[model samples]
Target: MEVKSSPYYYSLALLFILNLIGTDSLWASPYFQSGDSIESRREVIEFDESLIEAYQADEAYNYFKNVREESAWEKFKHWLSLQWNRFLEWLLSGISEGNFWNYMALVLKILLILGLGLLIAWLFNKYYVVSQKSPPADQSELNLSEDERLIQQKDLSTLIEEAESEGNYRLASRYLFLNILKHLKDYNFIEYQFQKTNTDYKSEITQQDIRSDFSYASRFYEFVWYGDFKLGVTDFKAAKMRFENLIRNIHNSKTHG
Candidate 1:
């Protein structure tokens, strides 16, 4: 029997076709949605049954499940995707009644607020909280007697001379540079700022030019201390000149002003 179709009947048929497509998209077994939590043991059992049916119908699961040596990162990503799918499902279900553009706008606003909050937190931690800590206790106390200071200077000079005599040029350079830094700290020319207990001394020298000079000296000291490359006689001579110049500058700055 042939039936004539009205416009209402045609529209109804179109809606039914679209609904079938949507159901098929939602029910597809291969691509799991992000953030899908296992809500119940019953849900898990149902999922296993569905998986068994899918394996029987399609041959892909057998091959994938047989892969034994998956990396830790791969497993983590898989679990993360599953959780994401569960979250997405909850979010979509709640927002389904709203207009699509309104939901999208809400999501963007939430993201913007979250980003701004994180940025503010990071700035506060970096500039305000971290900067307020005191310098090392030993560095703050400048109560050394003149004789003690002279003895320290003498010990440092002897160490430098011994290293040079032994032809351990690298050690000699490092000893000389570190001695200068120690002297600077003792004289209150620079404050020892502790990042950790082990690595103390951040330069709080006020003058930019002096800070730059100290940084250059420190870099060269580190290079000689840690690097395997040999320094030539000319390089040693240059280092000595720079060291003497630095001492003179510090003394001059103290006396003239």
Candidate 2:
């Protein structure tokens, strides 16, 4: 005959059965059902292993890059330290050897270099790139003999008349300017220096009205002569009028004075 089990044993057995069932469910894969075969599980395990390997490779590469950067920085620091030590040693040795005069000479050489640089900069500013386009104060006439100078000092009025007769209005306008300057020179209103710019003469003319007339004539001369503008008969007439005005003003000032 079969023996009957105790109630406590029977309850314990039921609980163990339920716990096993719950644990099986808890341990099941979320991607695949618990019922999947071993082959499917093997493929998923291989995929996880490949992912881990790839992650390990990326970590190794990053570690290698960090090591290389740190090594480069250390090398640069070492080189700089070596250079600094060499410089300190050289400086100390030179000082200890009583070569003070040599050091002084070096300092003097540096100062000379600095002075040269400053002089070059000054030359660039003064000559290469003039701030104001005014001509140099030393530029006037070319050197010539006294006899040649006498021959060249023909009267401006006669030159103008000859130029007009030749139908060279451009040349005549130039002579008209020279005549005004000659009159100015004779009256001692302004020094007729070859190096003197028109602005210089303008400054010398203390009279406002006279300076105004000179400015007009000087501007006309600069434009037609230096500007490369083709001077026609009409331009010549205007230039002559301005020159005449300048001459008359100079004469009037002289007479009044």
Candidate 3:
């Protein structure tokens, strides 16, 4: 061969450097370059073709689309069609006979369809109607209205004594709450009005401690009396104690102030 100088030597040196870097890069042909060209390499996506494939894949839509397809629904439809044709033929034959028996058969077929429809409706009502209906309201809680019926009497002290003597703690709790309201009214902290709700009373009281004490007594009275919850001796005593403590505290504050 001819003696090659600079060109041959430079080519050999370049190849040696590439080999040193690693032989892995040799596999990166134009065909397997990277995933960036994969989308471009794919066949053109036609909307019509994709839509057809999707429709074919949908079993439910296909079931109704191609009526001749062999499925359970088709089997049922085929049987029904066969029965209906047979019935028509029989009916025609019976009509040709010109007798009462043919009319009876037609009437019976109509009745059967109506009965089946009624049965389906009744089954739906039996299972679904109850869940659709709203439940009844609980009668255990009293309604705290704006009516003055809550603080009914002026002389609650006498009523309280009478209720205590009779051992009617529920009645006594009610009477005690009335007495608390009376005290508040006398103190000019709140005006006794039939139109004023419990919320009104709380709003009228500027003192935080008094409002808290009054709310407790008021709720207790409602739960016992209006709510129809029978208060036992121990329950009544606790309620009475709370009311008396609050009343005593209020009395002392007024006296000392």
Q: Per-residue lDDT of 1-257 in model 3, one digit per residue for the tens? A: 99767888999999999896666665565666666576776797557988888889988677566446689988899999999999788656676767898878877877887999999999887545543443233353223451255456566678788878888776677668778887777676688886676779888887778889999887776566655566788888888889998887677655211
Supply candidate 2's per-residue lDDT for 234: 77
**Candidate 2, run of 10 with poorest lDDT:** 138-147
Instruction: In angstroms, give how far residue 148 of model 2 lies from its true place.
Output: 11
**What is the number of residue pairs that collide in model 3?**
0
Give the Å error, residue 81, model 3.
Answer: 40
Q: In candidate 2, what are the lDDT values of residues 1-257, reduced to their tens digit? A: 99889999999999999999988887784755666777765743236788777887885556545333458888899999999998666544555566878678657766877999999999886543543343223222222122123323756678677777777775566567667777777677887677677789888877888778888887766555444446787778777887887888787775322
Give the range where candidate 3 is weakest over 10 consecutive residues by summed lDDT. Answer: 134-143
lDDT values of the candidates?
0.63, 0.68, 0.72
The global Cα lDDT (0 to 1) of model 2 is: 0.68
Root-mean-square deviation of every model: 28.5, 22.2, 24.6
Cα error, residue 108 of model 1, in Å, equals 44
Q: Model 2: residues >4 Å from true position, as ranges? A: 1-154, 255-257
Residues 51-83 of candidate 1: C-alpha lDDT, one tens digit per residue: 678777786555555547979999999999999
